[model samples]
Target: MLLEAHSLSFSYGNTPALSDLTVSLPNGATGLLGPNGAGKTTFVRIIMGLLRIPKGKLRVHGREVATESKALKAVIGLVPEGEILVPDITAVQYTAYAGRISGLSSTEAMDRAHMVLHYVGLGGDRYRKIDGYSKGMRQRLKLAQALVHDPKLLILDEPTDGMDPKARDEMLDLLKELGNDHGKDLLLCTHLLDDVRRVCRRVLVLSQGRKMGLVDIEMQGKDTDLYAVTMRGPIPPFIDFLESHGFKVDVDTDGEGQIALSRGAADQFIQHAVSQSVQIRRLVPLRESLEEVFTRLVSKDT
Candidate 1:
């Protein structure tokens, strides 16, 4: 296990942030997804040891984070949500400084900084002032700084928040490479469904200060098969008939309906249409996207 949170709870003076959240994360890339004020930031703060664990257990790398925060931080790297760079400093200088802050010696820090800069594709611009760097370049710089110490675990919060489509794709590609080929465990926190779908295998969802669910990104919203059916006459009768026959059905006002069923329900659907004296104009399979899955889950929880 890479992370385990059992009954984790936190709050401000009056409002609750996280409420009885428990999850176990394996070694790989996972996404933390939620809306605003869903306690995603609170969870990250607890993992980074910036906030004290007030209620329950949190373990990273099999070590309890509340008692062994220093050890946990030593093995964890974080790229925070917003810009934390010094305007006057260069990328190489900032990255080396970050390495030293992580307990590397001066020489080792410089060496690793150079190597990670190249690895992040910032080798040529490493010496330029961070104040003038583009947003994408700055995001890469943050990633380079986070990787300079070569920690075992990396946590990124809203890494591609402000990026354009092209830059976002580029950043996601780099993250895929890091998580898949570099043997690093990653936790990406974002609300972007596509980002999570593209980079993570698992997703932990939070809503209204509670754990909505944890789901496999690749396998979610796939079990129930959906078909768009258009009929010549009375769709309500057909829908009610299908429901009575154990198939879930919904319809629009235009005599078009969506039928959801298990593997062997299609034969029953055809039988129902024929017996009900309805004409089936067209039937097409509708693939559910990840966005729909996220929306459905969040709406259900909320």
Candidate 2:
């Protein structure tokens, strides 16, 4: 596990920010999904050692968060939510400064700054002042600075908060490459379900200061035995047959049918198909969209 939190809880004076949360994030891209005030930011802050952990236990890279925070800082790079860049400094200068602050030698910091700027697609404009850059460019700059230290894990907070569709897509592709090809573990903190669906392999959903649950985004809403079926022959009888046998059924155009029932019912469904002389051309389980998963989790928590 890259990150492990057990019964983690936090409070802001009288208000609870996190409550008995337990989750483990593995190597690869994971999303910290929640609406505003859902404790996502607080959770990141605690892991980064910016905030005090008054209760529970958290381990980052197998090091206790509260006791070994300094060591964790050396391996965890953070791209914070708000604007933190100096307006007058160029991309290289700012990125190099970040590397230096992370304990890199000035010479090595400058070398890495150039390399990371190019890596983040800022090579052409590496000399531009931060104040003059567009929103997308600034976002990339934050990523470059985060990468300047060459940390093992990258935590990005709302990486695509304000961007056009094209820019958003480009960022997602870049992140995917970083996690998949470059061997970087990434934690994406965002409420946008589409972003998580596209970029993250696993997700931890939080709501109202509590963890709704963690799920592998690819496998979410797949535990149920709801399959989409398409056939070449008549389907009406098959649909009726399923419903009469306590299976939920939905029929569509062109001999498409959807059946929801227990996994045990599969044998029964198959047996019925043979008896009814219906050809089972194709049967695929329907996958729930990220939006559906998020909505279901939040609603159930409420």
Candidate 3:
């Protein structure tokens, strides 16, 4: 586990912000998903050592969060939920400053600043005053500064917040690049279910300061991949047969008889259909969408 929280709890005065929460994030992208006030920001603050943990155990990179705070801080990158930059500073200078503040040598800081500026889509514009940049550009600047330190893990709080559709897509593209091309681990903190589904490989959902669910994002089931099979024979009885035998069948029309659902048991569904003497042409199980998962989790929480 790259990040772990065991029974972590925290409070604001008498009000609890995190309640007995326990979760572990691995090397790839993981989502901290929930609506606003669900403790996502508080959780990130705790791991970053900005918020004091009055109770529970928290660790990052195998170092205790409270006692080994310095060690954890050195390895983790944080794109805070709020803007923390001087508007008059240029991207290159501010990013270099960030690296130096993280204890990098002056030479290393300059090199990293240049590299991250290009990485985040700020080229010639990198020399422009940050105040002139757009919302998306500012968000990218925050991400670039965080990466200036070359931390192994990146924690982003609503990285796409307040962006137009184009900017949001661009941000998502950059996030995918960081995770896939650069191999940077990510803890994506946001309530945006679409972002979680598109970018993260695992998700932990929180609600009302409590954990609602955690799920492994299975792109394909190990033994069996789900497929949607569309055939042109006896739709009603076929669907009935599937459902009657403990299978979940969904009907659809793409100029076919009916749409049937099959899991890793593709072979079984095929055999059953053959035994029933139904002609088959197309079978496809639309991969479960992230939206489906988020809806299920949030609904259950309420």
TM-score, predicted candidate 3 vs. hidden true structure: 0.85
CA shift at 48, candidate 1, in angstroms?
0.3
Model 3 regions more than 4 Å off: 220-229, 234-266
lDDT by residue (102-214, candidate 1, tens digit) is 99999999999999999888999989988999888888899998999988999999899778898899889989988999988999999887888889999888887788878
Which residue pairs in candidate 2 collide?
A: none
lDDT of each: 0.87, 0.87, 0.82
Q: For candidate 2, write residues 168-236 as lDDT tens digits.
A: 898899889889998999999987878887888999899988989788977776786888887655677
Error of 1 at 144 (Å): 0.6
Using all chains and alpha carbons, the TM-scores for the candidates as numbered come to 0.82, 0.91, 0.85
Error of 1 at 251 (Å): 10
Compared to the true structure, candidate 2 yields what TM-score? 0.91
The residue ranges of model 2 lying beyond 4 angstroms of the native Cα positions read 231-256, 264-268
* Residues 1-302 of candidate 3: C-alpha lDDT, one tens digit per residue: 77888889998988888999988777889988887778888998888999988889998888898998887787788998787888688989999999988889999999999999998888678888888887778898999999999898999998998888988898898888888888989999987878877788888888777888777776423323445566766667877788788776666543253333434566787787888777678765555556676677788878
Ten-residue stretch with the least lDDT total in model 3: 253-262
